[model samples]
Target: MSTEERLIESARALLWERGYTGTSPKAIQQRAGAGQGSMYHHFSGKPDLALAAIRRTAEEMRAEAEEQFSAPGTAVDRIGAYLRRERDVLRGCPIGRLTQDPDVMADPVLRAPVDETLAWLRGRLAEVLEEGCERGELVGAPDPRAVAATIVATLQGGYVLARAADSVQPFEQAVAGLLDFLAARVPTDHE
Candidate 1:
C-alpha cells in the first residue's frame, strides 16, 4: 500500500483499539512504518489522519450493512440477518467504540463520520421497515423510525454487554432476544 493508505489503515486499527485520546501521531507513524515527514506530507496532522481513518471505517461499516440490507427477505428477516452476521463480537464495533471516546464526541470533525454513518444505518433500516409494511409483510403500521433506533441500540448495547462479560454469549443472546421480539411483532394469520 501507499504511505497514505498505510497511515490510514494504521490509524483505523489504533483508533479502534485505543480511542482518539490514546492514539498518538508517533504511535501511528510507528505502526504504519512511515516517518513523520511522510505522515505530515499526506495529512495536516494527527486529527486529519484520524478523520480519514474514521471516514474509511464509516464507509466500510455502511457497505457491510448495505450488503445485508440488500439481501432478499422480509424487513425483519433482513434485520435478523444483519444482527446474526459474523462479527468479532469480543472486539466490538469499530465505529460504535468511537462513541465512547470523549475526544471524538467533543470534536465535531471527528464525530461527523460516526454520526452520519449511524444515521444512515437507522434511516436505511427504517426504509426497509416501511417497505415491509407497504408489501403487507408487516400487518401492523409500526413506527419505522422507532424500530430502527431500537435495532441499532440493541446491537450496540449487545457489544457492550459482551465486552463487559468478556464473552460472546451475551451478544449472541441479545441478538437472539431481539430477533424473537421482532418475530413476535409480526402479525400471524390468526391475529
Candidate 2:
C-alpha cells in the first residue's frame, strides 16, 4: 500500500489498541514501516493522521451494522441479529474505546467522527423500531428513540463489563437480557 494508506491503517490499529495518548507517531511509523519524512509528507501531524483513521473506522463500523439493520426480518429479529453478531469481545469497540480517552474526548476535531457515528447508530436503531411498531409487529412497543439509546448504552456498557471481568460472558449475557426484553414486546400473532 501507499505510504499515506499505510499510515492511516497503522494509526487506526494503534489508536484502537492503545488510546490516543498511547499511540505515538513513532509507533505508527514503525508499525507502518514508513519513514518519518514519508509520514510527514502524507499527514500534517499525528492528529491529522488519527482523524483519517478514525473516520475510516467509523465508516467501516456503520457498514457492518447496516448489513444487519437492512437485512430482511422483523425489527426485533434484526436487532437480535445485530446484538448476537460475532465480535472480538475482549478487545472492546474501536470507536467506543475512544470515549474513554481524555485527549480524544477533549479535542473536538478528533471527537467529531466518533460522536456522529454513535448518533447515527442510535438514529438507525430507532428507525427500525419505529418501522416495526408501525407494522404492528412490535405492538405496544416503547418509544423508539429511548429504546435505541438504551440499546446503544447497553452494548457499550456490556463491553466495559466484559473487559473488566476479562471474559465475554458478560457481553453475551447483556445481549441475552436485551433480546429477552425485546421478545416480550413482540406481538403474539407475530411470534
Candidate 3:
C-alpha cells in the first residue's frame, strides 16, 4: 500500500485498539512503518488522518449492513442474517467503541461519523421493520422505530456484555433472544 493508505489503515487499527486519546501520531507512524515526514506530507496531522480512518470504518460498516438489508429474504430473515453474521465479538465494535472515548465524543468533527453511522443503522432497520408490517409478515409488531432502537441497543449491549465477561456466549445469547422475539412476531401464515 501507498504511504498514505498505510497511514490511514494504521490509524484505523490503532483507533479501534486504542481510543483517540491513546493513539498518538508517533504510534500511528510506527505502526504504518512511515516516517514523520511521510505522515505529515500525506496529512495535516493526527486528527485529519484519524477522521479519514473513522470515515472509512463507518463506510465499510454501512456496506456490510447493506449486504444483509438488500438480500432476498423477509425482513426478519435479513435482520437475523445480520445479527448472526460472523464478527470478532470479543474485540467489540469499531464504531461503537468510539462512543466511549471522551476525546472522540467531545469533538463534533470526530464524532460525526460515529453518530451518523448509528443513526443510519437504526433508520435502516426501522425501514425494514416497516416493510415487514406493510407486507403483513410481522403481525402485531411494535413501532418500527422503537424496535429498531431496541435491536441496536441489544447488539451494542451484547458487545459490552461479551467483552465484560471475556466470552462470546453473552453476545450469542443476546442475539438469540432477539431473534426469538422477532420470530414470535412472524405471522403463522407467512411462516
Candidate 4:
C-alpha cells in the first residue's frame, strides 16, 4: 500500500484502540512503518490524520448498518439483525468510541464525522421504527426519534459497560434486554 494509505489505515486501528487523546503521532508512524517526514507529508498533524481515519471509519459503519436496514424482513427483524451482528464489542464502535474522547469532542472539524455518523445512524433507526409502527409491528407512543436515541445510547453505554467489566457479556445482555423490550412493544393482532 502507499505510505499515505498505510498511515491512515494504521492510524484508524490505533485511534479505535487508544482514542484520539491516547494515540500519539509517533505511535501511528511506527505502526504504519512510515518515516516522520512521510507522515507529515501526508498529514499536517495528528488531528488531521485522525480526522481522515474517523471519516473513513464512519463511512464503513454507515454502510454496514445500511446493509441490515435494507435487508429483507420486518423493521424489528432488520434492527435485531443489526444489533446481533458480530462485533468487537470490547473495542467498541470506532465512531461511538470517539464520543468519549475529550479531544475529538472539542474540535468541530475533528468531531463532525463522529457526530454526523451517530446522528445519521439514529435517524436510520428512527426511520425503521416509524416503518414498523406503520406496518403494525410496533405499538404505543410512536416516538421514533426518542426510541432511536435510546437504541444508540444503549449501544454506546453497552460498550462502556462491557469494557469496564472486560467481557462482551454486558453488551450481549443489553442487546437481549433491548430486543425483549422491543418485542413486548409488538402489537397483538387484535390491538
Q: Which is the leading candidate under lDDT?
A: 3
* Alpha-carbon RMSD of each model: 1.7, 0.7, 0.6, 1.7
Which residue pairs come into collision in candidate 4?
none
State every prediction's TM-score relative to the real structure.
0.96, 0.98, 0.98, 0.95
Question: Candidates' lDDT values, in order?
Answer: 0.92, 0.94, 0.96, 0.91
Model 3 lDDT-worst window of ten: 132-141
How would you encode candidate 1's per-residue C-alpha lDDT over 49-164 as one tens digit per residue? Answer: 99999999999999999998999988888988899999999899999999999999999999999999999999999999898788777765559999889889989999999999
For model 4, residues 1-191, the per-residue Cα lDDT tens digits are 99999999999999998998789999999999999999999899998999899999999999999999989888789999999999999888889888889999999999899989999999999999999888888888348999899999999999999999999999999999889888888876723
Name the lDDT value of residue 36 in candidate 4.
96
Range of the 10 consecutive residues with the lowest summed lDDT in candidate 1: 182-191
Two-way lDDT contest, 1 vs 3, winner: 3
What C-alpha root-mean-square deviation, in Å, does candidate 1 show against the real structure?
A: 1.7
Superposition error at 113 for model 2 (Å) = 0.5
Q: List the residue pairs that clash in candidate 3.
A: none
